[model samples]
Target: MAVSMVGTNSLYTCLDMIDKMVSVNEGYIAKAILALLETEKCVVEGAGAVTLAAIMEGKLPELQGKR
Candidate 1:
């Protein structure tokens, strides 16, 4: 499933949102998201990336398998 983090707001600006579905048994995905955002300051202020981070890491089980 794909998690649509790009809301009606203009957080994404003009950056392209990349959605990738991944297995979630382990915490690798979240960890990766945190690491990427932490190390990559260029991705800062990009609402699309932020939304992707939430989808890949923050969302709960109820949110998974659906969006």
Candidate 2:
């Protein structure tokens, strides 16, 4: 419906700005959370841990060996 479409403008805008998209499953998210909690002593929620999950799982190959 026209009314529901209003909220998706931001999603469209974001899509315009990105060149690539990647994803990780719940297991990867869980592992990232455990790694953070054990190694960094930090408590983070699933959404907050997603980027690190992608990195830890090698989803972002561009970041490899870049310090």
Candidate 3:
């Protein structure tokens, strides 16, 4: 099987930092994709789900309760 890689080189540094902060593993990615499919009725690839995964994993606690 051909393994596909996610994420872009332009955002690699930022993504790496977020991954470290939130532990963006396969499980979180899977949950993000499932959530998009169920709620938005659309399919999203791994790169596209990174932000959602971070949010779902609650990595941005600083943004909590801020509008």
Candidate 4:
């Protein structure tokens, strides 16, 4: 399970809206951060990079090509 400093309301909203959840390790998070920096010229913190990490790790194949 993942816990965050995010607000309860935001957590509640996410719980209500999301159909699935996936977990990625620190290595994936680090890779994601580097990927964003290297490819998109963007820098993101670990928590902010998790979704991309999941996608990169093939944990969310269903989300491929999604908007």
- For every model shown, what is its TM-score relative to the native structure? 0.26, 0.72, 0.58, 0.71
- Which sections of candidate 3 miss by over 4 Å? 1-23, 63-67
Error of 4 at 19 (Å): 1.0
lDDT of each: 0.50, 0.81, 0.74, 0.86
Clashing pairs in 4: none
- Screening candidate 3 with a backbone cut-off below 3 angstroms (N, C-alpha, C), the clashing residue pairs are none
Quote the lDDT for 9 in model 1. 59
- The weakest ten consecutive residues by lDDT in model 3 span 1-10
User: What local lDDT does model 4 show for residue 51?
Assistant: 92
Q: lDDT ranking from best to worst?
A: 4, 2, 3, 1
Which pairs clash (backbone N, Cα, C closer than 3 Å) in model 2? Answer: none
In model 1, what is the error at residue 63, expressed in angstroms? 30
Candidate 1 stretches with Cα past 4 Å from truth are: 2-26, 42-67
- As for lDDT, the candidate ahead, 3 or 4, is 4
Q: Residue by residue across 1-67, what tens digits does model 4's lDDT show?
A: 3666767887797987888867798899999999999989997899888999998888999988887
Q: Write the per-residue lDDT of candidate 3 for residues 1-67, one digit (tens) a residue.
A: 1237545774676775554444576788889999999999989898888778777777867655554
